[model samples]
Target: MTDLVRARLRTTVLLIVAVLVETTLGSDLRIAGVAPDFMILVVICAGLTGGTLSGAFVGFWAGLLYDMFLTATPVGLSALTYCLIGAAIGALRTSVLQERKSLLPAAALIGTAAGVLLFVGAGDVLGQTQLLGAGRAWLIRVMIVESLWNAVLALPVGYVYAWVARGSAGAERVGSPVRRTSRSAVPTVK
Candidate 1:
């Protein structure tokens, strides 16, 4: 089998395992009245490592799978939120950010916080008032705690995501030598 096929297989297997773990042990691993969202962590790491399109694609599937297991809101809610979040993170990484050891945790921290707000806000806008039923204070707590949790877990998850995404076009771009484009000596008229 080709390396591309192998990478896709690895990514698929990783997502499956992540979904299983998030659905089963996720609740049991709760801390301070909130559970760590492994799926979101995976999505964020995928985005940070794989770039915009890759992140969005993974986020869509991960959110869709997560939606299947959710009873609180409509099926597409998580999918939309996660897709946007992943895409945004990936775009940011590609444009504004550089690869660094601390980037994983920072991305996880910010991504989770953004995701919580987006999920709740989108749910509320979609008339899923129950999402905001917990009130603002609860939302704040969840955002803080979840972000922290994701930040702590970012490194391990990032390593796994990198492994899974290996051999793909985007993955190969990461950690490789930066390519410089040749510039013309003469400036073109607008």
Candidate 2:
């Protein structure tokens, strides 16, 4: 099969696996009371590698799936939050941001934090109001811990994501060494 076709298939399957793990294994493997936010990681990866449409599409569906399984809030809230996060991160891929040192991990860290904040903020606005629930101290603690969790997860998740994309696209299967006619031959731009 073609690389593109393989990528699409892999991406779909990955999303399913992410959701399954999020609902099932996530609870079993919680450090304290927080899960790995696998769906968020997947969405971030999609945005980084697949562009806005892929990110938004995957984010919407993934978040919706999570929302459906969740007992806490309304269904569309997470969906909307992920949609925005995916779009924003995917848009950033077009700039010099990705080339900077530590850009990918930084993006993941920032994106994850933003995503969580947006989720809670939306819940608060929609009258879910978990932001103020359990008092200010608990809320701050949750934020700090979750942020740290996300930061810890960012690098490995991003690596896996890049690997998945490259593998699916067949970009990583073979190295192409350009034949040089001179000492400093630059390949022509497409």
Candidate 3:
């Protein structure tokens, strides 16, 4: 199989595992009444690694799968939220964000915060008043706690995502050989 296909397959497997972990163990790992969202983390990683289109595509499916396990809100809500977050991250990655050792964690911190706000805001706008029933203070608390949680987990998760996305479109391979044109083929501009 082609490398892109293999990469996609690996990513799909990772998504399934992330959802399983989120549904099974994520609830048990809450801090300050906020749980880590592995689904959003995966979508963040996809955006960081694979660019806008890939981020949106993966986000839609990931949110859809996650929606199946959710009982409170409408089915497509998460999908829309995730898709927009992923696309925003991807766009930032390509144009504004610089590559650095701390990129993943930083992105996770900011992205997760934005995601929490967007999810709740959009839900509230769409008549899901229950999302904001706890009031602004609760929302802020959840946003802060969840963003910290994701930032702490970003390194390992980002590493795995980089591995899974290897050879896929827009994935940057570490230590890849630089293409050097032969000097002899070009006329010397003496």
Candidate 4:
């Protein structure tokens, strides 16, 4: 399989794992009643490393999965939010963002804030006003804390993504020959 295809398949699996982790295991891992948004972190990582389409695709699936696990909001709410977040982050990547140092964590931090707002707004529109249940102060607190958590995860997640995509470890090596199944590379990248 081509590297791009292998990369995308890896991203897809990660997305599923993220949904399971965030909604299932992660939900139980709250700090002051707030759990870090892992799905957003994963999608942001994918987009920052994998490019626009990859971001959008992963974001949509990850969001949908999260929606399924979290609330009764319409299935596509999180999907649409995450999809847009991924695309926006990917587009931002093309211009001033330096992938060398500023890319991964920056994307994770900003995207996490945006993703939280987007999800909350979408939930509000869908009549899940409970998102605002904590009130504005609590809402801002959620955003700030979640953004911080995502930023903390950004480096490690981004490095793992780089390893999966380009076989990187800071300015060290090029591609290390890797094994991949060809079928895993097809539908996702196309």
* Candidate that would win on lDDT: 3
User: What is the Cα-based lDDT of residue 141 in candidate 3?
Assistant: 96
State the lDDT of candidate 2 residue by residue for 17-55, as single tens digits.
Answer: 888877897677666666667788778767755556667
Better of 2 and 4 by TM-score: 4
Per-model TM against the reference: 0.87, 0.77, 0.89, 0.79
Q: After superposing candidate 4, which stretches have Cα over 4 Å from the reference?
A: 166-190
**Candidate 3 wrongly placed segments (more than 4 Å):** 169-190
Q: How far out, in Å, is residue 169 in model 3?
A: 4.2
> Which of the two candidates, 2 or 4, achieves a greater lDDT against the reference?
4
Ranking by TM-score: 3, 1, 4, 2
Task: For candidate 4, give the lDDT of residue 83.
Answer: 97
The Cα local distance difference test for each model comes to 0.78, 0.66, 0.80, 0.68
Clash counts for the predictions, in order: 0, 0, 0, 0
Q: Which lDDT tens digits does candidate 1 get at residues 97-179?
A: 66555777888899999999999999999899998887999999999999998889877776677667777655522322132
Per-residue C-alpha lDDT of model 3 across residues 1-190, encoded as one tens digit per residue:
9998898899899999999999999999899899999999889888866667777888899999899899999999999989998888877776677656677788889989999999999999999999999999999999999999999998778777877878764444111212222222211110
Better of 2 and 3 by TM-score: 3
Question: Which candidate number has the best TM-score?
Answer: 3
lDDT of 3 at 129: 93
**Which portions of model 1 miss their true places by more than 4 Å?**
169-190
